[model samples]
Target: MSPLIELRGVTKSYGDHTVLRGIDLEVAAHEVISLIGASGCGKSTLLRCVNGLETIDGGEIAVDGDVVSGPGVDLVRLRRQVGMVFQSYNLFPHMTVLQNAVLAPVKTGLCSKEEAEERAMAMLGRVGLADRAGSYPDQMSGGQQQRAAIARTMLMSPRILLLDEITSALDPELVIEVLNIVQDLAESGMTMLLTTHEMGFAREISGRVCFLHGGGILEQGPPAQIFDDPAEQRTRDFLRKVSLAGRL
Candidate 1:
């Protein structure tokens, strides 16, 4: 079977600064992969490019066989199929959780107002936030807010999820709740590509792991091999440093 997501010679640069140099990857349907690397290694940029949030400077990106990079692409349609959640929990401050989750589907005509609310309520329950549906962002814990953000994304019924350090802004104690939802998503066969600082969770949950260095993929393999037996020296060094920092 062909990959559900494919990148060929992907490159991105911002004036003098370059990120994601010649990245080539393929993600099968239902596969969960984590991109691991040091800061500025272009992991997040790669995800954004995949979602068309950032235009690539070179090469091509195809999702489910549709070319998504370059001009003439319908970004709004692409985004609906490619859900993304950020570290900052970008929930609207004034909207209640239920209202936030229901807005998109109702406005886009994906569902009627009543149907969107029903679906959003069920999704909130799935993320353990049904009781908090009426609460505003400021009234929730960091974990709850992130879960709300995730619920909003999932309600789009995306074919793929791009998580850009979704737990990076949470307290250490709050990280697990978000990760647990990710764990559930993976087990439920949600296709996901994520950039993460949580090495243990990546090792535990990823179908594969890629180590990015100098804006390109340096090594990629099954989690055990990539995390425990990486062949590249840079990969080894990065793992060792993060391990010594108690980040592993």
Candidate 2:
């Protein structure tokens, strides 16, 4: 299958500090790939680059055959095909759940309000939030708010989703609810690039697991191989640290 997203020699840095180096990666259509690493290892930065939220200083990023970060790429259009869900439930508190979900399609694509609301209702239902359609973000828990955020992104009908540690900011009990919704999406054939510290979920759900460290991907493979028998010393050591810390 052709890759839904591809990167070649991608690098990103801020002034004197480099966050990613010579990164080459790809996400196949309908595949769920997880990037797992300790804090500050550039996993989140990599996810940002995938969705055009962060600009790379050099190299190329392509999403569905269109250049995303290289010459001649229209980032505005590219982003419409790639949606992002952040750790914080970045919902507009002023809008109801359905309104927040439908805003993007109605504003960016100039879709009719009625059509957008219908699409939004369907997506919110997919995430099991149909009954709460008129609730404001502030009226919900973190889990519900995040689910609303996911629904909002889904209304855009994106082909690829970038999740940047989306559950990190949630209460411990709320994490599983969000993760369960994501797992359902993965099972239903959504192409995803997820960065998370949730090792067990990564091992259980990802088609491939990538380990990043020191501004680069240290090792990557199928979940069984990467989690059980990583090839890189840094990966093994990092796993040990998170494991001993009771994070794995």
lDDT of 2: 0.88
Predicted candidate 1 versus true structure: per-residue lDDT over 1-248, tens digit per residue: 98999999999999999988899999999999999999999999999999998999999999999999999999879988999999999999999999999988888878899999999999999999999999999999999999999999999899999999988898899989998999999999999999998898799779999999999999999999998899999999999999998778
Residue 137 lDDT, candidate 1, scale 0-100 = 98
Show model 1 residue runs off by greater than 4 Å: none
TM-score of each predicted structure versus truth:
0.98, 0.96
Q: After best superposition, candidate 2 residue 185: deviation in angstroms? A: 1.1
Residue runs of model 2 more than 4 Å from their true location after superposition: none
The Cα error of candidate 2 at residue 218, in Å, is: 0.8
Give the top-scoring candidate (lDDT).
Answer: 1
lDDT of 2 by residue, 106-132 (tens): 888748899999888888888889999
